[model samples]
Target chain A: MRKAYSSLESLRGLCGLRICLAGSRPFKREVNSVKSRAKRLGLNSLTFPRRMYLFAAPALALFLVFWVFPLIQMFFYSFTNFNGINFNYDFVGLKNFVNIFKDGTLGNSIRNTLVYTIVMVGASNLLGLAIALALNSNIRLKTLFRTCCYIPALFSAIVVGFIWSYVYMPRSGLLVSLITLVGGDASKLNILGNHKVALYGIALVEVWKGFGSTMIIYLAGLQTLDENLLEAARIDGCNEWQLMRLVKLPLISATITINVILSAIGGLKAFDYAFIMTSGGPGKATNTLMFNVYRIAFNEQLMGKASALSVISFFCIIIVTVLMLYVMNKREVEL
Target chain B: MRKFRLKPQSVLLHAFLLCFCVLIIYPLLIVLSSSLRPPGNMDSPLLLFNQFSFASYIRAFEKMQYPKALLNSILTSGASVLVIVLFSSMAAYPVSRIKSKTSRFLYYFFIAGLIVPSQMVVVPVAQMIGRLSIPNNRFTPMIMFITCSLPFSTFLYAGFMKSVPVEIEESAYIDGAGLWTRFAWFVLPLLKPATVSVAITQGMWIWNDYFYPMIFVTRRDQFSIPVVMLQFLGDRENPAQWNILFAACVLCALPLIAVFAVMQKQFVTGIAAGAVKG
Candidate 1:
């Protein structure tokens, strides 16, 4: 332990030396040259303009106070037992985290969150790719169709939830009525009520609402592909399926990865829909990590535990992001 | 007859596309149809083709007090977009203009803001706002909107500003134009396309945002449209009249949908450009 401490002290000393070097005469000479060049070019000195920094001050200050500080405090609080009020608490050292491990609701929330992420991300990207491909064809009013499809994505999550709620209402919902018209038993189809189907129902709504944005992204990726490759494949007697599978998919691999990561992060942080639609539902069926955090923090006033959950969720998101980057980089290197 | 073989596959593709389009359009059509349905006839199974009425629209307008909420949303979101665009562009100018290590460090720090989820900071921000004695008002939420939007807008503006040939600014400098003047006349005008795209993207987000306003603004009169609609649905006293709620939703969504439809080409092009540039 003493040796480790000495090593850390040496590292700090090295950092201090570097800082001294940065502030030494050689740096001043470099600054003088840069300033002279700036004068010749009718520009400000190399040192950032005081007024410009002042103008940028509000943004930087707000981010630090509101974003950075809160995140740091949240990390600290996660290790403690500070409830919502009277921010005085002891650091119990992983007790809260240990509690989470044994907590069934949290386990369920994690499961639900993962399930939602996989299904929503998978379905949205698949549907989006399909839509992009279909729209890529020689169709009339293509622009109109694309715009129409993307309209739902512009609606706020709250509004989308409300609209879907009305659509899923058991009594007079459009969906229920349609089911009845087809001679299917509509009474048993309370999508938001059934435990088994509620999570999937929410995932379906999310996919429906989000697919258009992903489709547009894929469409952009498609535009970047070389038409010559497709022609060559066709000339080589490749069928449409084989041509797309071999040529188009590989070309747009990066975009698919991006879409998947975006969708996954979106799923993990999802709150508005679950809050508005099911409020974490009949027996925590649709209770995701974010929803549980909100409930625990706001409703139950368990701030420390909630922060711990959020930190866990944040780590989960990072892991997924790293995995995505790894996969994308591997693909790039292989190509 | 020589090329008839491709016709079958093409027809099959079209059939699949058409079915998917219908599926996508179904819920929206439902909302439109339901909003138009007379209030008393909502329970009927055959309500799809029922004669339409504006009764629910009228009632929703009255109950939700939508006009005031719409005004609030427009004012807040518009002001946010204006402030974010103006300030972010001003800040991005120097960052992009200077090629120093410090400036690059600051630029990366600004972009890092995008990855941190805003929801994670809600607790402390709320506490800070409360502690600072800033009353729960529309302006508070508007400020929050601008603050959250700054990083992305700045990143976008900086990226675009780099592509802008420095020659334009050099000529302005040679003309003895001051820094502010150069930015105002030369840089700002050239940034119009980026500005419009930023406005649309961030404006749509702020206008549709429910969480910030729901948590910050307490007064019903100060509530934005999305929060108001959410309250109407979640309120227990008058549990959201479904038809009326759908009518209000349709109204709330119409402006954005109209803007998107009209600017569909620019919207898609801008997003594609932004993604590629990023």
Candidate 2:
């Protein structure tokens, strides 16, 4: 038995040696055959393993169940008179949409949301760009100023809104106190209470909390500007204003696009301040798209109406986003 | 020695920035100071560091159920972020690796969620939550957060995953390493930067978002920090106690501010990186 085992082991070793002597070229040929075979069979084992797709199944399942399904159901509900409490509701068709339009809710919220987006996109960009320019330059205490400026952005909207409501409070508010300190008459400074100024008031609060982040993005983009190019421009007799307008603006167009789109989207979702500070009040003066949705859905118990409103806003948002992206991309390419 | 001379332009820039900083910071300082004043001191002067009392803190703490809300906030947001990172990276892997029609469809499918804001679908989602009898608890809000975050998180992960060479993964696969093993060992470690971006940005949103919790969580004790602060909103019947409300705001914002103070570089860089990349 021992002799047979030794002879078997030697035979195996001889086979291994023979295979090694001949294996290298055949191995390459075999791999190439496998590759060609896989290609012919439309089976890309290297890239498209059937087993690999299983990794995405969990997230995809969650996405479909939680996100896609809900959105589809939202569309369905927009057509029915589902009052949120009852499961047995009738199809109302276009009635909800017509009702919202006739009552002026749609037009009012759209106008207010547009105004808010304009203010946010305008004020946030200008202030953020200016701050970014100043901070990007050679300045003292750069980190300290940046951090302090960003502190408000760190706080929750609830906190920021609450604080600002107090600031905009009547004679006892901080704005009044500041004006008094500066020797200005401060009697008629009820910003949040006045219907004409209420929307602007909340929009400014949005800007205050948002501009820091916008500034940071602008600063990042500004840092990428070539210092040598600026120096060369300076050598060619470009003033600071000329340098900024001519050299800096064109280079950072991408960042401006990003900030504008972000602030626009954020402004369109203006609910928290209107909800917290104004309660969509001063006679629906600050009733934004989102707050109107909340008011109709929760307070009025009109889920169908709210869903219709949401569908309108959804189309509005998607169109606005696509349009902005197209226009901005064109502008960026042109620049 | 060089003469210490301030250039006029530099001086003007500094002065303007100083006023801007003051404008940004003074309101927060007012909240801080008002929170420290004695309870019922609504008429207290808006000066910094004038009072040394925690009376409002104590009152607000009890009123807002500080300990419970803080624990809920930490647990929910932390769990949501952990799962968001894991699920999103896994989902992004195939989308990035495979070159097929299905993969392309899935990539755009996830990216489509970016434009459709969650509030647009809140009605049906809320109804589905009720109809399905999902328990309105802290974890419920976590599910909402994770679901809402997956779009951007997956977008981020997919962008990062394209940069990862397939050679490493293929080699590992040929070496008899299984899919999960290769992913855990090879892909995840290399994805540390994207992971940090995901964690910081999504973590900040989940932590600060009161909207989801306000909609989903019905139990008072299950309220997150921002929702708990909502309790201080005074209606006509009950006037807002300004001091206590300010105190609650401070308490609510304290943890994030502390984390930011420590991880300022990470927070700033992570957000900027995510924004730029996305």
Candidate 3:
């Protein structure tokens, strides 16, 4: 993405030029309209330049209303004991937040989400890196392989979840049938029924659906590798495994960090597979933070707690993301 | 000399990859097979092309209100693509072209939306939409689709625009072309690839997206395909209606996959470049 348009660039000489025509007008201006008239005329007059804000008004309106406003409402409502449908609710004063801590499912949900994140992020990136390495080799029909690898990702997460539910559908499911075919006597297997395995089972599908994109990203990153470096390492008597560990791995550390961070964030907020595969399970085994937020808000009608959860989730996501980015940035070698 | 296929490494790689491909495509094959079968709990894991039929597809289409749902999805996603492309492209102009102190600040301000973890905002957005008395409306999600999509779209457009030299617009200015004219005639044509990338990326996103639609769209008729499919998958009128449900799943996925097939490279390239979503 950092590489600028190579062959596909259509624009000739329009970007970096001084957009202000010579001797036309200064780009910035200090307007001196009457103060009250300026107030009546609006804040736009005092702020952004006409053309720039004209270009940005629609998007900013949307950004303010849909994204920014709701977030404020979410925070304020989190402090209240508000039911979802009505405007009548007293200020609960951390009651909802306290209840969240006391709520057993909250702890369970957080743990399950962490477990899901760890397994999904770990398994998918490792598997994705492996497949990327395999496809990165000199091979026939590489495009076909790439497409096939990515087809699962093309399906909606809901659809993928539904399809995998069929795959894990106890005795008659494809997975069970496959196991039975190998004389494993797994016909009565109920992967989604057992709380112990259900989270991981759902995580499996998430990994399955997600790894293709990870592979594609890795593949693209691999293409950017300096081949002479690899050849030099080989000439230094590095074997295939040594070359991978010493040359390929460290060189692709940037890609590794990127893929890990993305998949980790994805895993932390994973809802579709958990919700669809087991309906948050035979128990609340797969109840992720997002899914629990949905359940509380819509199902249980505890909008206050849900709003609190959403606020917590927002901060949790931001803090973790920033920390990961900071740590990764610190660790990234200049090479 | 031994044939190239005789290499142990090549054999191992091919075997691993072929098996991997089958695993990946197997559930898809099951969907295809089940969509062809009569309403039944399919027990077999083996794929049977000989049993293929479209009877389930025909019934599944009606049961899921496939046509209406499809139209809703198309209208919403198509509108999202157009809105994002237009606003973001227009917005990209002043941000990229005009070198000023505020432009950098504006760029970061807009791009900050990308970090807000959109799913977190769903709670209040749903309630706010309800308060606005437009709950269950398509246009509400349209606002969301645009808002959530803008940061990346604007980023991409601005990035692409940076490669475009400012001389062309200046030349157009010399010829007495107004801003909108330069934008419409000269600038938009120059933004062809960026526009398509945004359209393809955001369009697919809005189409495949189920969460927002599931929350906002309450009526059966208004439900997008994914939302409707989820509703029905839970209710299944008959226990043996797995085939029809699978058929619905297939139908829901087919159009996007078709879109993917035609614009495979763009879809992949857009995703790899943008990383729009967390």
Best by TM-score: 2
Give the docking tier of candidate 3.
Answer: acceptable
Q: Model 3: residues >4 Å from true position, as ranges?
A: A1-50, B1-6, B45-47, B97-101, B131-135, B166-188, B235-239, B275-278
Question: Residues B1-278, candidate 3, lDDT per residue (tens digit)?
Answer: 93556678987898899899988898898788777887674656466665767787888898888889999998898888888999898888778776555778888878777667666778788767777787468656787889998987998888888877778877887798777887789878987778777887678768888888877776788878887778656644344778888888899999988988888888777666654222
Query: Model 2 - which docking category?
Result: medium
Tens-digit per-residue lDDT, B1-278, candidate 1: 44445577677777777777887887887778878976644565344646678998998888778789889989998888898888888878878887667679889888777655667667877877877888989878876788788888888899898988988877877788777887889889999878877887788889899889988988889888888887666531233366677788888898888887688788887765555555
So what's the TM-score on candidate 1?
A: 0.86
Top candidate (DockQ): 2
In model 2, which runs have C-alpha deviations exceeding 4 angstroms?
A: A1-41, A333-335, B1-5, B235-240
In model 1, pairs of residues that clash are none
| DockQ, cand. 2 | 0.51
Give the per-residue lDDT digits (tens) of candidate 2, residues B1-278. 95757889889989999998998999988989988987777664467787789998999999988999999999998999999999999999888987677899999999888777777777778767777889888888777798888989999999888888889998898898888998889998998889999999899878999999998888998899999887777721222478888888899999999999999998888877677777
TM-score of chain B of each: 0.91, 0.94, 0.88
- For candidate 2, lDDT tens digit of each residue in A109-189? 999999999998999999999999999998889999989878888889888888888888887788998888888999988
lDDT of 3 at B228: 77
lDDT of 1 at A284: 86
Give one clash count per candidate, in the order shown: 0, 0, 8
